[model samples]
Target: MNFSAPTGNGGTALLRRLVWLRFVAVGLLMPGLTIWTSPVRANPHGGSVVHGDIHIGAGTGGHLQIHQGSANAIINWDSFSIAAGELTQFLQPGTSSAVLNRVTGGDPSAIHGALQANGNVFVINPNGILVGPGGTIDVHGLVLSTLDVSDGEFLAGGDQVFKGASDQGVTNLGRINAIGGDVFLIGKTVTNSGAITATGRVGLAAGEEVLLTAAENASGERIFVRATGSGVSGTGITNDG
Candidate 1:
């Protein structure tokens, strides 16, 4: 049975079949091309957010929420900046985990900013040093100094270490109960608006030598020195309420 479109009897039927064949061929070719050209979408099933991937928005921001799970966040840059509406939780690694790990490029990649955890805070700078866990407050940092806190009721258990060769005394207006370590005042000026009461021992050193200031003049703006270690130097001082 030879079917010809010129006879016009089976012409309409042939046209319908031809149209159906073309449609099927297009359907087969489209799916493979589409899959190959599209961008990779996120797989949010396993509670894993990989690095090297960036998410952008229209001036609003992005939110990442993990419920009842641990978080391992790392930022190794010259300086990491955080703006409004950013919250992170670490279920594990209170003092053990190095959340603020050092950058690979040594001192060249020093970090600077205010890091405020749920209970504690840690602030650091280029020429200054701080070592302590923040207790229920924010840790503020400057360009030339650093601060650290440890052993508090509110903040988690950890060893905060601070170091610097600056010549300015640190003013602690907030509550910091230094359980261990020494209060080092290598700086020339000594003034504390915040209380400098130590729980363990305090050590004052200056360039590989133990520094001791003798009989500073009170009337001529004497540089006050308070050491709470083995011996008490000054007479009984009143604690301002």
Candidate 2:
């Protein structure tokens, strides 16, 4: 026995289905499902002393310890990311010492752990910077920026000028405390949704360029944003917490 399928409308529907199937077969295949997670970096990797007397070593429990012998030091890293349950510390000469850490890689610096220093710590990455929910920063002074400052300006030590065209900004979603010092966050867009405590001052500036200078008095402004002629739009500085 021979069986025949429905014709007329059924034939039209069958033709349409065949055409659709052919079109899909010739078209680009649907992409496979992809899942992405943040890279787990236990410590700051690929660090090299760029300018100053500094030593990098590992401590117990995968902690990164940087010993800076000079009053001011500059260290460049391929990437500076600390995973949860990790700590990165800087032991400088004293509370007056400072260390500049620049990330040279394409990825931004992710602080998902603990970052502590005895003196001042300056971190610059044009890509962007994120202090995650569990991250913590404790230092005498702290400067986190998406702008760029020349080595000459940093080594000179008086007033450091940071200027860059990077649209990537700096965000803090963790805890930051500066003991008897100031905390400055500079970028195209600066945001703080975490806790920030400073004995001196806390400045968040969003602009193309900014000048950081020592406060004339103990209680004064230390960050000055430059005018870009066109002016900035929207809320440049956001503090939700």
Clash number for every model? 20, 0
**All candidates: CA RMSD in angstroms?**
34.3, 19.5
TM-score of each: 0.26, 0.81
lDDT of 2 by residue, 21-46 (tens): 11121111113211113685678888
Model 2 alpha-carbon drift over 4 Å, by segment: 1-37, 217-219, 233-235
Task: Give the alpha carbon lDDT tens digit for every residue of 76-190 in model 1.
Answer: 3232222223322222223222223212221211111122332112222232222112211122211112222221311232222233333322222233333222233222211
Q: Candidate 2: minimum summed lDDT over ten consecutive residues — where?
A: 13-22
Best model number under lDDT? 2
User: What is the clash tally of candidate 1?
Assistant: 20
Q: Cα miss at 171, model 2 (Å)?
A: 0.7
Alpha carbon deviation, residue 104, candidate 1 (Å)? 13
